[model samples]
Target: MAFGTGNQIRTAGRFIRSVFLGPQLAAFLPAVMLGAYWFGGEGVLLVAAVILPALIAFAGLASRGLDLRSPRDSVTGLPGRDHLVRHLDITARATGGNDSQARVGLVIEIDNFRGLQGMYGESGAEAILRQTSERIAGVMRRDDLIASLGNGRFGIAMEKTPRVDLETMIRLSTRLQEAIAAPFSIDGARILVTACVGFALPGRVPDQTGDAYLAAAESALAEAQRSGPASIRAFTRAMRPRVSVPDALTKEVVRALEDGQIRPWFQPQISTDTGALTGFEALARWEHPEKGRIAPGAFLPAIARAGLFERLGEVILFNALTAIREWDRAGLEVPTVAVNFSPDELRNPELFDKLRWELDRFDLAPERLTIEVLEDVVAKSDDDVVTRNIAALSKLGCPIDLDDFGTGHASIANIRRFNVNRIKIDRSFVTRVDTDRDQQNMVAAILTMAERLGLATLGEGVESHGEHAMLSQLGCSHVQGYSIAKPMPFEETGAWIIENQRRICDHPRLPRQAG
Candidate 1:
């Protein structure tokens, strides 16, 4: 069931108390009018009839798209993303395909924005964004289009000018970073922020369409982010990931799933205490016959774009359950296989039953298959079906592992509310836990909290022996990353498990202290 529709909002109370005005509420006008009349008189009923439609109509337009005089972001007072894109398109066309005169498009994404949101609250995050946006806008020319792209991102369309080059983009990116790095004060507390920047030069954006230019910049921005915080990258042909598939990504995703090209690659997770195999996570991989391997990041979006999230989830679930049974047959003693479900799949009213039937069909115990939910889903969920489905899954004995812990809005209350069995410490904190004092302190705090709550903890992205030693000392139950074992196909798991079993060391290998 799509979360965007009424299936998720079956209750009248939820509809009434919903913070955002939705067009679906249009159908409830008659009921609302009757309620108004019951509570008040003809005067109130007349007032409701006149005012409700206007509000709904305005909200509907805003929800669909703001078509009138280009909309501005409420917090930043800058143009919205659409306005920047439109202006970029106009500027690009006015250049008449002349690369020298074409405008540049850049995107600046605030680093760890969600972490800031989680730490300081939404309003604090907004204040940071507002101040940062003003600084960014000030860095650009008065006429150069600047936009608030939401999610701690800003889009910039440079005024069409000649002599645009990589050097110019780099200089401008530096200025933007400087602006973002400036400390922000929210209620007497000073918060420092950094941003990654990506820009596409006019000539690099092939069609010079606003959407294409923006996408190129975003791709570069992704590259910059991958490099590190406060990094900058100019768009290049190589930045775009190549998936050796059909011309259309969406089309290829549909065919790949049907042809069995997309499947699970199991990454082993081990007990940090004993280094014994506890389980493996079933991460999706697309293996093209010609290309050998395709990155999930490249095609997963295509799956979502094609509205195949539910289908993808079904495929992964079946593969995971099958893997668990296979491991059982091989006497591997692998306890469970974790599979992630998209928000759309979690919202399905039939998810609980579907999972039960799948487990039954595979003749596997419910505990043998772990269900992984993103912290974002737990944090932002408003759908009744999602909440009920998660609770039902927990009741049925399947462990729920919240993925990317500490990165999203999931709180202690929400974690308990959703029956989370385990928290996977995000790689951000785990990256330098062995040598970085700050990283060690953060992981220690998270582990302490988890221990207090009696929740199992796993640290992700544990890449070094020292880091593994530190996490073990800090009392993480499990660890998973390249240091343990990179993801492998089902065919390789048997031998890999056998070989890896010999590598298991005793608990407390050494009392290594982290920085």
Candidate 2:
């Protein structure tokens, strides 16, 4: 009974400290002063003013590392970014700038969170954030500080411990991803989400400041997101993401998209056995005036945040058709142009009409433009409009090429339902297929499945001649990657096409391996 009473007293003390010393105290301070003036005159009001602030400051000083001045995130009930950074600074200072005593800083951001918010409402998005935070906290130690960094991102500062290292952080990152990626249900909708993780190890950090550590982790997270969904990246000396201010970056993205600075750069896809030009995939690239060439990774998030995905799609589709038409006029026999459509764009009700109009405008066959869709959309999307749009396009003679095939765990039924003509194998399975027996087996299995399903297979990311040869011998119908050709602007494609034809005519195709 005595222990229970002591515990209750401590809890009451914590409540008082949190309320009176937290940022919420600002809300009630004016009222408290007003009441004091009404009841006890000017002297009491002045006394209350000084005493209240001093008391709050004293309460804050009593709780070291808590950072009472730091704000809180209403969505996840975690400390705000300021609090985590403040803790980081305090730790750095206390440890006397010793890397041996420093801790790990992690940032986990849900991939494509804007898409979720666009599909569902803000309330539903908040629910996901809350659940994600809960999962993160459940796996963390009590000493670990978790903060909501806004925009579907969370930050964690782990307590200093010798047990934590690179391998440990990697495992923890994987565990956190697993916890967050488990199916979420909100308002009768089942949502599947994945997160990219970035962490700063003390030993690898060049600078000792709190901002430096946090920025490094954020940079790594940005890099991870570029690799694909659920990817992880650790901080390196060369990684820096988004040096500009938020408002500045947003403005630049808006102008870049509107002023034709952002457009498609085409990459050629070829027949592996014959080295013939089969098609070209239209990829988005941003050409900044002063920055030279900006990677899609650096600006895509800004584009999504600005709600201009559909507009970007319009630009790509237009550019792709223009390229094809230009090639036609130049007598270049580029068979087809492949354009990818995001799930949000695919869900547009007028997508079918828009595609048909674009085809009519270009005076090209529907088969001349291939529609590429991510496998995740096929596996996870339940929207009837997306389904209808894809079906209508397939029926209209636009070949449906499924992008990043093996990553989404898409079933055969989903493939058949969407009428996918070709499945482009993800680079994860194709990275080193020539030397890795396991990769060879995996490619073989996929090829066998594709053959049985009557779906053409294309091995993506063929980087070396050996990988190219292995893919051809595996009976992969087509291949696309840096080995064949990097993405180029329309003007450069003519020269590349001519050069590729000359080279292939002089070289012999690798023969298939007999079973």
Candidate 3:
């Protein structure tokens, strides 16, 4: 029979009780006469025969009781592997979907489940599994499906969801957060367990069956697991392809780095107070022979994977320093030029020595180059090692600026730990400064903190007059945004500077560009 509902069980229990206890008492009374008849006389035999039907009814009632066994594991009392598969099969047959709007899957694997087993023993792991299962079961709806996909990995499938309905998906994620956040009790001790979840929406329907949506979810889940516990990542188009860059293209990129095809485009950084060009933040570009010019984001990661970042950093630095020397010769009076340094470049023990050697090679003053380190790399790194390297680089007379300051989780700690020369507010904040109260407050707080620490501040991504006016009012000393100038090639920057100098000489305040 179908398991039916809880109300059915309760009604059944009551009916069984009535059969045994209501008019059923008369049936048992005759059974007493039958027992007496077996010992007494033939007259009692008639009474015993009449009681037989009542005895049968009472026996049926005795069998009705609740099954109280825990259906799943103790640590995560999720159902056993077979039970999970059954759940998946039922759901897949009934409601699974093929499109992004209609399908979603979750693959959650407890990070290092066996490590906990080693620490607490097999029995301890069992207890944890039971508790974990109870929590997970409590969080899920009756109709939703979950399956133990083996080795501490569980799969969840949500049918009929769209990318735009991600808020609903996030609500499901909260259940996982709650389940993992609550500490599991194992052997009289509370052990905190953390897990990472990877999720995907089915792109197509199964031709073969056996929960194809579950498999896609598992793939996304594995990526999240590799990234580490507590990290969640969704599958994207980039993760779908396994294609490698052509060998010729790879070689061309490497060749470009070696042949000085790489150059820095200096976007002028303006002084909010003086409204004149203060410096430039150097951005790297490759004038590929075929592609013409490739943005850094398009190919940098691939190049870094091929172990070319250190060489690439050196090339960009060489070009930027060369440009700085030329700018000085042209009497630009620029104070600094910020160049981005990759973590791969910074982590190199000999990076400082190599930078010094390059500075000497081009006769560039160390004070003119401000190395901009990404916040994420600095935050994740061995701070002591990075701090020492930054100090050594500082002693060489070049300052260090913390780039993309508010972008990472550990920004505040990074600012305090490193002897940074400047903090540039990330463009995301500056782009909407006029309308976003939170962004305005964040920018204000960063400026206030930098001032107290006595470090210079630069606001990046100032695209409008309102943004510029706001930053100026808040005493942001250095600013870079399209309102001033877009990132241009070095030659263009030079031309714009001459024009700006002419305009300033004519009028004290630079006029706003025509809308």
Q: Sort the candidates on lDDT, descending order.
A: 2, 1, 3
* Candidate 2 vs. true structure, TM-score: 0.59
Poorly placed runs, candidate 2 (over 4 Å): 1-248
lDDT of 1 by residue, 1-515 (tens): 35435545655644563434677777888899999999998999999999988887777665534346777788888778788888888777767557677878899989878777876788998898888888987899876778888889899888767678888778889988988776678898645567899988877777767887888888788777756567798888766542332438799789899888999999999987677899999999888887556666568778877899999988888888888888888888899999998999998999999999998999988899898999989998989999999999999999999999986768889999999999999876786578777677788889888878889999987767877888888888899987777788999999998877777643446553452
Give lDDT tens digits, candidate 3, residues 391-474.
Answer: 788878888888777655455666666667888886656755766666677678888888888989888767678888777777
Candidate 2: tens digits of C-alpha lDDT, residues 1-515:
67669779988988877876865677799899999999999999989988988877776677764555567788887888888887777676555445567777899999767756755679989999999999999999888999999889999998887665778889999999989967788998656677999998876777677787788898888778756567899988777543444645878888888899999999999998778899999999987887566677568878888888999999999999999899999999999999999877998999999999999999999999999999889989899999999999999999999998876778999999999999999776786689777678888999999999999999987768898999999899899987788788888999998888888877787888786
- TM-score per model over all chains: 0.58, 0.59, 0.51
RMSD to native for every prediction? 16.7, 11.8, 13.4
Best candidate, lDDT-wise? 2
For each candidate in the order shown, give its overall lDDT on alpha carbons.
0.82, 0.85, 0.67
For model 3 the local lDDT of residue 446 reads 80
- Which structure among the candidates has the greatest TM-score? 2
Whole-structure CA lDDT of model 3? 0.67
- Model 1 lDDT-worst window of ten: 238-247
